[model samples]
Target: MDPDLPSSSLAVVLVRARNPLNVGAAARAMSNFGVKDLRVVGDYLQPLEAARSAIDAAPVLASAQAFSSVAEAIADCTLVYGTTALGDRDLHHPVDVLRDAPSHVRQNPGRTAILFGSEKTGLSNDELSHCHRLLTIPMARGGVSMNLGQAVAVCLYELHRDAPAQRNLPEPAAAATADDLDRFESLLRETLTAAEYDRRFPGNMGANETRELVRRLGLTSADTTVWMGMLRQVLWKLRQAGR
Candidate 1:
């Protein structure tokens, strides 16, 4: 374990995971890597008993928090990374190779959450919407999707590996929390709508572009506040002009 890395600052969030065994295995991996926080979104059967597979990680499983939605699960995390296989899906979030993500995560000063989806379908577009970035584990051509447990182990191992050397790196600025980013997005959307930007494009194209733009910005806490204030002022001006 890296003396400089606080296990509590990293959270492993399982979204709509159907198998309790896989969940337990993930917890076990977290224990191996010294990451202490575990969060589950959605329900699973007999979580407590199945978590016995966590071995010595039973305490980690025991302390896991449950939420009804992904947004709720990682609300406080400053950085949210969603894992995906990139199968026949349009990726709006910027993709980060799994091997490189750990070092980027290590530099961040705020809490980070790594989200993994269910075994069968993986993360849906709605769940992906809550993430700031996407990560994919590299494999051979035509390789089968990695098992949930194994994927968790590999990702956490990368994060834990060579932590001591990274300890000396300069700390990154405090990034915006998921909730803060959400608020900024909401305000930006409202401003766009107030300015009738949505009317120019058919369907949700405007809103979707707005979301992608926001995610790509990778705003810090201060950036979020500034954007929110600016958007709100624009919205007010739009309303005043309309009146």
Candidate 2:
């Protein structure tokens, strides 16, 4: 949570948003929370101007870089989070940012970006795929959802609450991320195939089961690398033994 580094490490990305006012408002909100970099993805900034919202934080808007796709905007970032409303995306876990934000940022420091989609349709599943995790603010169920500015404010508020961050996390001596769990799933599936574990079912294990079981372990980045390393060794050892 090193304050200076924290501010620099995180950014907000708006993807194909059609509202100019919301764009301006979001940039203003981000600056208020000590975030200086805002990357907007669209053909250009016309919609942002139409919203008439970010005028006060004009500098942020002035320098905002526009990208054609989400990947280019977030590619350099090591940790990326997307905002989502869907519950059926089985490969990723649905985490409440309010309860999970602090720990997540503390653990994964570097160029990080949180994404918001267009006002009309929200983020696509493919756009979300680029993110390692998802963030959403809870609201009373109804036809209304928070406007883009409001959403930005709330997220920054939570992010800035324990202001001027100091990196305070356990630095997991052993663990893995959802991505690592994904790779593990592949490895396990291959092993199961080789061992004929699928003969009984003739298909394969459900992905939800894989995600849930690995997520239960809360593996750190380091933990995943180590675990994969060990897995390779164990497999090689078995091969040598058989020979």
Candidate 3:
């Protein structure tokens, strides 16, 4: 099945990447696929060189939180996926990465951190145990290992391919916005004027614009009612406070 929330419940855990350019490139790849977070163990982004490498993904680098050890890096993640080329060890699945891709990511997630080891050894066995399972890139024999950044990019893209596109947050409920309220008040005034009501408008200004704003914002019924209450409060003030 396709992933539900997308934004990849995925995070890349790079242990001693050993190259600023690779880290930056990985950050860029993370940003590209909407991976949720990253955790790097060992010295990382020492001089912000990774941010420069991230290109337009500077925000990803800037916002990337850090950790000291592999266990610490993954402590908060509920499902942990590890990547490895040397599967000579005792792993349940010998050489398949995509077999149960979506379930492994979505089945368990307070967060899911996909671990990538150093540029040289991939993940050490100690790091491997921390993971719930493995995500292996299928390759023909004699294929050179994937570049670190490219490896992360491929894994994240595969995991999130079917998930929905997400923005930082849902547009704050339109009703909760001052901008929406202001437009609605303006519309109430204009609608009254257009019906030969508020004389101050004369030619009836701000009505069309206000209505358009409300419509464009996709205001809900609840939003209209809230605005109506606000207008009532304003009208009560117009009674001159029992003067």
Candidate 4:
């Protein structure tokens, strides 16, 4: 983890976790490692009692944010990583080993969100599509996946372990938030549609590719703002021309 980056800037996101105990345990782990942000996506059982298992992490549990979608939950984050068990499913994002993830994360600026999937089924393909990268915790061959809470704890521990000694660290750059990226993608998609770019592709292929491309660009805050303005102007002109 970047010594300059505060753990508070990191968020642990639980997606459709079914157990309140697991939620509490994850919160406890977050507290143990100094990460304070927790975001829950989709429906879960006994969400309110999650604090009981949080122990001294009650504050974290109490303040956990709930969202209807993974994209919405990470809207303000700049870097998003999705955890997986390395199942046989096809993946589009680059995979990062647990040990190497901390360094990659520390290299990025602004808020970072690490996502854990549901207890029964891990992150869906759609959910994974939103991630900039995939992370897999190495385990013995044929080993079963760790419990949701345990997995969260292990990942957080790795990020917190051997943390660099405090020093005058350079401040992180202002990266574009997920929401900013979404806006840019939306405008770009609209402009592309108005220009009949999608007609050249099948179904929503153009739109989906545009979304993925926007994320891959990893734009800074200023870059996003400038692009949004440029795209909006183009879209406006296109609309006028069509009139």
> Against the unseen true structure, what C-alpha lDDT does each candidate score?
0.82, 0.73, 0.68, 0.83
State residue 231's C-alpha deviation in candidate 2, in Å: 82
lDDT of 1 at 185: 86
As for TM-score, the candidate ahead, 2 or 4, is 4
Query: Compared with the true structure, what per-residue lDDT tens digits does model 3 show for residues 141-238?
Result: 42346799999888877777666556566766544456556656665674454444556654534556555555576666576777777666765565
For model 4 the local lDDT of residue 94 reads 96
Worst 10 residues of 4 by lDDT: 44-53
| Number of the candidate with higher TM-score, 2 or 3 | 2
Deviation (Å) of 49 in candidate 2: 5.3
Highest lDDT scorer: 4
Q: Estimate each model's TM-score.
A: 0.62, 0.60, 0.59, 0.62
The residue-by-residue lDDT of candidate 1 on 34-79, one tens digit each, is 8888988885545534665455555788788888889899989989
Candidate 2 lDDT over 129-224, as tens digits, reads 898887877667523456888888888888778664456776546556567788976776666555556687654466666557667777777777
Which pairs clash (backbone N, Cα, C closer than 3 Å) in model 3? 97-136
lDDT of 4 by residue, 12-78 (tens): 9999888888888888888778888898897653563555445554678878888989999999989
How well does model 4 score by local distance difference test?
Answer: 0.83
